[model samples]
Target: MLLLQANNVERRFGADILFHNVNMQIDEHSRTALVGRNGAGKTTLLKMIAGITEPDEGTISKAHDLSIGYLAQDQGLDSQNNIWDELDSVFAPLHEMEKSIHQLEEKLSSIDSTTDEYQYIIQQYDHLQTTFKEQGGFEYASKMRGVLTGFGFGEDMYDLPINSLSGGQKTKLALAKILLQEPQLLILDEPTNHLDMNVLNWLEDYLRGYNGSVLVVSHDRYFLDHVVSQVYDLDNQTLTHYTGNYSAFTKEKADWLRAEMKHYDQQQKKIAKLEDFVNKNLVRASTTKRAQARRKQLEKMDRMERPTTDDSSIHFSFHSDKDSGNEVLDVENLKVGYNENVLAGPLSFKERKGQRIGIIGPNGIGKSTLLKTILKKQPAISGSIKLGANLEIGYYDQEQQQLHPDKTVLDEVWDDHPEVPETEIRSLLGSFLFVGDDVFKTVKELSGGQKARLELTKLSFQPINFLILDEPTNHLDIDSREVLETAINEFTGTVLFVSHDRYFLNQVATDILNMSSTGITHYQGNYDDFVNETSTLSQNEDKTTIPSTTQTSSKKSAGQQSYQASKQNQRARRKIQREVDKFEQEMDSLQAKHDQIEQQMSAPEVATDIAKLSDLQKQLDECQQQLDQAEENWTDAAERLEEFDQE
Candidate 1:
């Protein structure tokens, strides 16, 4: 069954057309990933689908009984209730049932216990009690606790007033609310922006097994690949659907465009030949009828419009400096936490020179808290941090919640470092992809992603050898992410950053720091290495020994059937890919053989040698046959690849 449908949707912001003539249908159990450039109407289209905004033209239809929950990137928790109360509100239905059951028991007590009315009411009360139990109302508190923790809200924050939480915290709470609701269709915009890798991986598993459908608007490539089966790219004022994860979509989209270009070329040639016939013979008395027929054929041609091409990507590289002294940072008996409680450790961890580490754990597992303790803003209750000499720290806070709302982009940069000249400051911001009018927008108006970029922009201008970044890629567009990532990769200093962006982590981080209740655990490699080791642990629990540098993980187990199903899916996909690779090799061989035949035919000696020419012609025929077979095989392989990607 179709879950939702939108037809000929058009949206314009002022004079700029974000998108037009967009049509799409979301089906039952569909998992769609919406992607486009910064201003390419991905958000607007989602808004239209949710019926929050009216489109300039056309209508959107929703399936009967289909419930959608949209978690926007920027939202407010205006309630006065605490975080626990706020999240528990999603279970209002269960709450209502319990309330009614209590009321029925009270009514029975008001009447005579022996009366038929009282007896009937007692039976009704018993039924409501059973219903409440079945609805999990009896265990709702534990579920609430688990979800809130999963989203990163601390036990202290659980009772904190929602009105007092930070913007990012509110977003986290809102996400928690949405996830708890578990609606029929989920639409999450940049849901992973503030979440760390641990939460992200948990989400991947949750969404993978979700009974309902989901449509996500996210810049996190690794997360998208793990969850989404389809990609709906909103670009060039039209909706183009690619069936597959991000990687498969990339390969298949290219192949599709190439094939379209070939067909376009053929049509152009036919049109040109018809036009020539008409021009030359239209005025000739003998060939007037032939010219008219050719003209009619030309008029009937279906011209293909030019396709949109993605632009060149941006890149940035940092000037390399000598590596810092052996000990970049060392903490002794670090007991980090909020208010009063210890997080996971009287834990001690050290960042040696050239250790590119990724701090990962669930949302509230003190990933950011660890970085803050290092910065000295988040005071360690009892432990001490020792920093090496000449260690200059560049901190990227997720709250970006720094960058005074009153400060302009230029002012934010200039105010921080008065010694830096305007031209130099502007040059630095430009490197972070802030250009022209963008520099004038108040820090208050910047999106989370934008503010993140702006904050990083400020840090890049300063002389910092040691960098402490908290969700550095939160608001960056794809191009800006590449730039920031490149700068980090080339930087000679030690980086202790907290990021959930798997793609970024893969490219930049050298080691893995898994921070949990027990403190920090150091894996010998990057994110992939951590996943592999953990995967091994899952496979062999008894022999699994994690690093002493890291915290112990939760006692989590993957269901055997679920685990096997995932492995089987991967195996099947690989079988398909192997076939594609085989066909591609054969196709390449056929092309080489065809090229050899063409070379021989082009030779002057072969043209003169009639006897040799006949032999060559026979070989050429055989080669053509092989080429045709190869082409068919390639076509089949491509079709299968697309089919597999889309599903």
Candidate 2:
């Protein structure tokens, strides 16, 4: 059933129209991920749906008695109480009802055993019990506990002051409280940003099992891929819907853009032809009908505009030497941890020149620590880390460290490369979106992202062979990230980056060093390979053990204990098999989608018009090509898994 509806929704700010004619129906079972560029009014649209803000022109209706749980990007949860108290507060009304019911039961049981008053009270007591059960009172406590635990809050933390919790922890607690509320419509914004992967997975599972409607705004593709069944992309002052998860949405959008481009091409041709005929025949009285008809056709056409495609990682870079024989960094039995908790594995790892490695793990894992250890800001406890020769290292801390707050932006950027003129500095900064007066602003006055961009100017300066970036995308908006991504892609130097930005990882990494509880596992491909490997492994598990097919055999390399090694190996193989099976399933699905798109494009309604037909045909071609590539990758994954099964 539709939980909420928005018809002819038009929202405006000053003279700008954020969107218009956005008719929508949000159903109880549908999960939608809202996506748009920053400042595209996603949050504003959400506010309108929540009734917190009004649309300038529209009618919005909610299903009768429908309750919505709306969580803003940074939830302002007012509290000074304990965590458990804050969590249990969600059940306050139910708790009060339970108390009243219990009191009435006591009164009914205690007096006038055969009286009508007693009997009526007893009957009412039974009614209340039924009502409480219907309201999920029985599961309330356990569900609250489960939610807290799932979101990484320990039972011990239940007693801690909510005020003492970190901002991120507070966000998690707020999320837990909302989850426990279990409203008919759940709305969340960037809910997974501060969550670790394990918690994210738990949340994903929870949302998948949710009975209510779900709508969220998030940049985490993994979360969207797992939780959302549909995508509502807000673009160009319009709302467009696509069926399926993020990956499917990507393909669907690509096909749509291709179709649009084709339409544009065809319409241009038709317009040209009509214009030619009109120009040639309009003066002749004998051909007035043809000319008039052609003019009408031109006037009546609902002109098609070219659709934009994904910015597909920019093409940009530096020249580099491939050979390294000398040891650039050395360590023995290195170990790093904070407050007595271990961060990096005792088992040592090293980096050499000509290597482009990506360190990926859940948020707050040792990815940052490992990077810092290499930088020597954090000491390694017990394992050897030896960096190989001629490595001139340049580091990009996600924290935006290199920038000086007191310095002017121009002074900061030109301080090191002063030999270059001011014009060159301004021009270089302009590429990163710092234009005109922006270059003259003090670093202190700049926004976090602006400061990070200023710091990134160093990427243009250093003649270093090795670049170590810790979440270079942290301070970067999508555009800046794209610029830096392009520059990194073109750089001929060795790079080792620690990142959770999957898109960035997908485009940049040539190799992956995945840090997990079991230690580091090196994979020979980019981030996609890493995700496929891990996700594939996860699917293959047999209830308890996580098999590490490649991770096990490399004991001398991975340093897993001997007694459990073989068991791990067996499990790993099974997991690999499962992953391979999943790939086959996915590849088949992709092929089906390709065929479906082809059919739609081939339909007469879509294809009869030369312009529209050309567009559809072009999309059909891109889909076909994508399908072939997906199939090949699936086959390759299957072969590797087969090796595990053979064992």
User: Residue-wise lDDT of candidate 1 within 1-647, one digit each (tens)?
Assistant: 89998889888779988788888889888889998878777888888787788999888989887898987876656789998888888889998998898899779879999999998998898898988898788888887888776766668877899888887778777887887888899998888866666667767877877778899998888788778889987766788889988766766776787888888888888889889999999999999999999998877877887655553334454432445688888888888888878775766778888778887776667777778888888888788889997677778888776689988998998998898888888887776567898888898888766787777777766777788888787777765676787688668788888887887886678898777787677788666667768777765765555654123333333342443354456456656886887888988998898889889988998999998989889988998898888889888988987897667
Question: How many angstroms is residue 539 displaced in model 2 relative to the true structure, after the best TM-score fit?
Answer: 8.7
RMSD of each: 10.8, 14.0
Poorest stretch of ten by lDDT in candidate 1: 549-558
Which ranges in model 2 have alpha carbons more than 4 Å from their true place?
A: 273-302, 308-332, 337-347, 352-354, 361-365, 378-384, 406-411, 445-457, 475-492, 502-647
Per-candidate local distance difference test: 0.79, 0.76
Candidate 2 lDDT, 226-330, residue by residue in tens: 689899888778888899877577657867877789989998999999999999999999998999999999999998767763242222243344534534444
